[model samples]
Target chain A: AVAAPAIAQSAPTIKWRLASSFPKSLDTIFAAAEVVAQHVKAATGGKFDIQIFAAGELVPGLGVLDAVKDGTVECCHTAGYYFIGKDPTFAFDAAIPFGLNSRQQNAWLWEGGGMELLRDFFKDYNIHNIPCGNTGTQMGGWYRKELKTLADLKGLKMRIGGLGGPVLARLGVVPQQIAAGDIYPALEKGTIDAVEWVGPYDDEKLGFNKVAKYYYYPGFWEGSAQLSLYINQKKFQELPKEYQQILEDACAYAHLEMQARYDIKNVNALRRLAAAGTQLRAFSKEVMSAANKEAFAMYDEYSAKNPKWKKIYEPWKKFRDDELLWFGVAEKSFDDFVHSTRGGKR
Target chain B: AVAAPAIAQSAPTIKWRLASSFPKSLDTIFAAAEVVAQHVKAATGGKFDIQIFAAGELVPGLGVLDAVKDGTVECCHTAGYYFIGKDPTFAFDAAIPFGLNSRQQNAWLWEGGGMELLRDFFKDYNIHNIPCGNTGTQMGGWYRKELKTLADLKGLKMRIGGLGGPVLARLGVVPQQIAAGDIYPALEKGTIDAVEWVGPYDDEKLGFNKVAKYYYYPGFWEGSAQLSLYINQKKFQELPKEYQQILEDACAYAHLEMQARYDIKNVNALRRLAAAGTQLRAFSKEVMSAANKEAFAMYDEYSAKNPKWKKIYEPWKKFRDDELLWFGVAEKSFDDFVHSTRGGKR
Candidate 1:
């Protein structure tokens, strides 16, 4: 048997409660919190434990940011955009329309000085944000009718999330902020003309295909939606340095896991959706082009109006542009070729 | 102040030595080992410490696999394809010519059953593998002269890494294997007509642009190269469960960190290279198509002769195809649109 070292004798036991903005039914997104908790607990020899509470268990889904900010829970898992009403800057922590994709988002936050900039911004809100998950590129919502042109989007009642609502609102879309559970019924009853939850896996679970015949490609608002862990600043500061490092590392682990889970799961889910006759349609270039123009205009206007948004937006935009140039050279050419010439007969 | 828990008293202290296949000057790749070590130490309050040794400090760079396998070192960070001379099957652990890109590779290993298959294979070598880093799709290589057609490759002497050599050999190219530090001198002196050494950041450090102005794109050979931590299975199983979990999570943290570092760093390096008059060229569609055909034929030949290769290649191929289909839809469409309409004039 091995002897316990002197260092272990000084390690403290602590417990934390994590509130998740997602329902347990959305396993891919919700599982990120579980992954963090599992790794943190296992690494700490159970000395540190985090109990998870699904949406509405501790607070309503949309209330998680405030719950974490006020220390109602020690931490919470949420998309930054969910709290955009508080400050449009929150969208940068998750995603904005026509922003970075999953890998590029990760590159921006982790290496392109985005974290440092955002950490400074988050100080005002009394929270610390760490990326915990990402839904690759989401499918555009299920449309009750095919949207073949920019004109088709006019007056469409869509249950969109976060800043996407405002961007869509520019294009004559009547954006409704319905809770996840309510989306199915709203779409079925024609109360909402369109809905986009996540990708194929999560959407299939919610049965959106049963109501909407046309499923779209590329949710422009969320080229990739990143989810974050928001820690109560005071509560986080109280933890031992070791525990703090463990928490950050655990979140990184979850971030990679969540993306991997979505990538593979979405592949099979999409194939199944296709087999069952879900009509997959790409947003026409006319719609995509117009949306692209509006998204940047929105960002430009925010830059002029909001100093906090401007601080992060300037660097973030440069990083995105640089990334696009580099990826265009090798990554795009390679992927386009390999994907076009898929290896299997299947 | 909080009191120490009884659980802390039972935690054991441990130390490990890590061998890296990269020189310290290659910070992005070498930093992965440091990232793992730093987190493991900080999270354990220095109770569990890991010391990193750069290439040749513990053993030669190419000898890391053997060092870890024989228990000469507790673990080592290196690319699996480096040992293909022992068995071509090792390529799956890193990259095969025209294989999955970085994200797809992570998805395959972590979620698409590739890890389980690889674990079973590694058991025979008495090692446990954990992904530590990935260099996203690499540049083809730097050439002294531009090659426009398949005929230009005939009898050309080039220094390439791992399985890429054999693939290139089929096109009448004579492949040279040279260490990273030696590649520049060889290219400068015209000892080799070309050399493919990673992407822009690392290549810039080597000053390849000064010697070879013709830099090619879409390294069809290494679409993405994954680096792994290979630990002695006996050493891993002997650790306390908590330490094992900590070590695994640390590798995952490093895995994400390394990729992000590359994604950001490469962007600036490429811009610098372009400004310095580095000629960026794409492999002709004719060349890309022929190389691609040869690559699949080679894989088919291996499957016909090698049972181990057959077992893994079949499933891996299917997963690759499914991924290609899924990515081609939304990811390709979104990225194509965004890149074509870059936000900045710069």
Candidate 2:
């Protein structure tokens, strides 16, 4: 259980550069990368330290994977969905339309076959993956107008997270792919009808509620958006076993902490949003039903055309379906009763 | 920032023993200490190694806190509620009747001032606590007879987690705190009428389904039972900053992972139990309501007598009540729709 004495005596320090898809302005999301860094440094007694780079500083936001794969940097913190255009299966690593929620996703990655399957896929790109952060189920979006019925989704013209865009499009919604910084201006100037960024914490900061009066949930598309750390395979393997595990444990800390912050922050931010006249809403059953059908249909199409997608989709569908049943019975049942009573207490 | 290189050059290794309240037979629960040890040693280059002693090896399972406080062991991995006889406030650290569920509990600790409040309380015992593991909402328990109404609970003999005992007692339950190993045989031989262990995973191992046909859920007392790593205060403070943070992060890793494993394992185990003719059931609405009512009343009683309980209880109730409202609207609404449709798909 011990390494060579000489290994400690030399005390060589390794410095790494970490690329993050999120800009520094989104502190809660971006801060997760720093959490990993701080914890790793503290664990290793400063023998290792990582410097974080914001989007476009060292590389463009979505280019994190490419940078890590090519060894441009030792690693990058990013959402896997950003690379979905390369292979739609990539979205499963982050979040997909109607995919598992945060608790279920963690179970999948840590226990069920998820980590093994995803690692096999990541191996092809010469990279390793660790869950680094999570933004809990997102808001549907901030809408300029209330979506009263199914027809409201027609030509919705909204900026959305990747995989859901296609699913939404099939339902007659005109989904827009806009840059993050430009979404506010686009919404403010009436170029788009709505936008979904994240949940209340980030949304409040983005001033989405100020411009758009109607706020909706659940984000149907992204149940639990997980951010990952992509490490170059060679560099990861070269680390001492303890250092490697420390990196992973550190990422796990950031992952759980990020979600905790959002869960806690969103409650008060949401209350503030409501007090400020932001109309909180839920998508109509009609809209939700149509979108659900489209999402599963798209999954079917991908399964038929792509063997890699087929391999993951078949099992993922089973995990998701089973989780839904179990959670529906206990989690949902308890929440329903407790929530109603909470209303009475208030 | 770097620690003294001379500190590393000395190659000094500090070995500490971790006492686990669980027996080796309960590997899933007992193994968390090993997980912490393996990770910590790796992070520190094997300079700090923790050897875990299962329950009864050094001291009795429930004596973990006392052992650590008296310096018999440097630390322990045990559930906080096990020490409730000493201070009822201890129940809040693990879980409480009608308390926060796993997600909310996590949010409370990492963000909602729970860690600070609990730490302040732990100070009186001259102990430091780090949340090390969690068992997600447990099975209400294994029942020999179906509970059809609140009246059925009169004089019911059941083995339950701590705080819930008082609540159940108020509603006519003869609460028996049985040893974990003795529970299976106690139920098998008709000594206890019902027993609530953890959920399906651990329950299956204990073979509860073989003897008790009816299985129930949403263990009202422990929505999430958090296992903590309790360190003697002086010893904890003596550690280097790097070592201190490593211990905390390692505990965090184990804490989140324990729940993930339970969430994943329970699904499969529940399936197996069902296949083996286990009569899966939900506690009747009447029973849940009485238990809920009694739980609150008990909390009020504790709040009146215990200063620590009162200080924490005031803020916790507000946090719990508010979270229920928010989760009810979004989380429950989404699950309700999605779960209903999953039935047809299967």
Candidate 3:
């Protein structure tokens, strides 16, 4: 018995199972987990192996956080905001309406004291969180009809992700929760008037364009959605420090790779969708303005009542504001000019 | 006999030297190399160790690339663009005048076929490149006086980086390549009219504010500067696969960390500089517009002359144009709104 522990200290063999809140068909999101697993295994010369299980294999997709918290699996890949029902504070780990974008989120988590705050918050759930990937600002969704004004949203039934639903509901839209497999059919048969998925790459995969002709710009409810790896705290603590560090760097590699995959794939997919006669539309200023107001009001209400929400929200808000101001300066000016130069012509 | 290679495959101790182009004083930039070294060592259970030598200890800052190319050191950390004197194509590996921003560059390199192109290009120099870090969009420079129009740029002597100088020279500016330590004295003594380092964090550390009254926004010359680790190709090929993957992941980890460090540190430093009476100014429309035109023209000239530059530039330009269009839609709208909501009061 003692020899096993001693041998492990040198070159121990360990196996871990990773549950993912996505199906294998959504390769970019699902492959991020595989990226982490492959790098970890390759870096350790196959001493450490992590097997990935897509959603519904080990537990339901929405059940990942609880599964990790209970040590049902060693870890899980998921969007933290999916568990907002348990506590709204979960959104801080993922995305909040009008919050930081993908790059800014990376800055906050890696350097601006976010990881420490999040790590402390996560302690209560017996989970150690590591960022895995981000879906840059998302498309609003696919709609059956055009959105012309704030009134156009009233009573419109749409299938959307969890955290964003409540915000839309406040604008008189009936936000429906539909399974990933069912979203396409729901939109096709007019069971739902609209559906919001990841973006051009994933949305095209789901054939949302086939069912709904109007594809909207900017999923305002989620400026940027971050995905995370939730490791069981006790299991993570018991690893050799070297293995722990290896696992972390592996996640960082996957985190970078996932966004890269999306950026390239989405570019190609958007072109195809456009050629196939998909109508791209922007949300009216009236709608975006109203929704932004409602979203902030909701956050204020939560801050007034929830201590945990207030603690993270205060600093997170400050970081977001500062980043916005800074980015608005150089980054915006350069990008605006370049973008305005259509076709790369001077 | 030949046990060294055999033992190295199974935890044999191996040590290598890393020459960093930056001194230890610039903690964020220099610390990126340390992050890579520390992570690799811990991941390999201390079996693989890398010792870092600051600039001038092993080689001059600008000499690190040639040092790696000639196997003087196992590897070195430096900006690829620093060697543009050898070939302008080196700028693609780092930054070009009005090139892709930090996030866009990451997307292009990791997913948009950029790494392959650059890797092939580096093979000619007996080097294998790994991206190490990035300084997001930089501030233009610390200006002794405000820029009123395009005419003011004529005959202005400014200390700038290597790659951006050519484009500026075409705009009637006399570009000077001054050593980092001497930049402050040169600016203070009125030998140079302006100086562009990194951003506020690094600029403030060098005390640019005391000498230059007016600071400027949007360093158009180098929209984003990327740093890389250049490994001696033959030495890199000799490493075990496990060690190789460990090294790659470590570089990515440091790459992400460096940008995050800059983002947070720059924000705080900008605030401090403003309170201390530093005046932040933007490059006038006339200056930015004229510079933009000349920059693209210079790129066209290089494309017509250098086959290597044309090979990478064509695809890179397309990817850049597509990225600009996409970012302009959702990201720009959301950020513009939130940033305009000054003081987070809205």
Best by DockQ: 1
lDDT of 3 by residue, A152-173 (tens): 8999999988568899999999
Docking class of 1: medium
lDDT of 1 by residue, A15-117 (tens): 9999998899999999999999988888777778899999999999889888888988999999999888889999998889889999999888888898999
Those runs of model 2 whose alpha carbons end farther than 4 Å from true positions after fitting are A5-7, A344-346, B1-7, B344-346
Clashes of 1: 0
lDDT on C-alpha atoms for all candidate structures: 0.89, 0.84, 0.86
TM-score per candidate? 0.97, 0.96, 0.96
Better of 1 and 3 by TM-score: 1
Worst 10 residues of 2 chain A by lDDT: A337-346
Regions of candidate 3 where Cα sits further than 4 Å from its true position: A1-9, A343-346, B1-9, B343-346
Please give the lDDT score for candidate 1. Answer: 0.89
Clashes (N, CA, C under 3 Å) per candidate: 0, 0, 0
C-alpha RMSD by candidate, in order: 2.9, 1.9, 3.3
lDDT of 2: 0.84
lDDT of 2 at A51: 95
Q: Indicate which candidate wins on lDDT.
A: 1
lDDT of 3 by residue, B1-346 (tens): 1112222246555699999999888889999999999998888777778999999998998999888989999999999888999999999888998899988899999999999999999999999999999988988988898889888888889989866798888888899999989999999999999998888889999999999989888888777889999999999998987788889999999999999999888877888888899987878878887888988898899999999999999999988888876676666667666665674321
- Ranked by TM-score, top first: 1, 2, 3
- For model 2, the DockQ equals 0.54
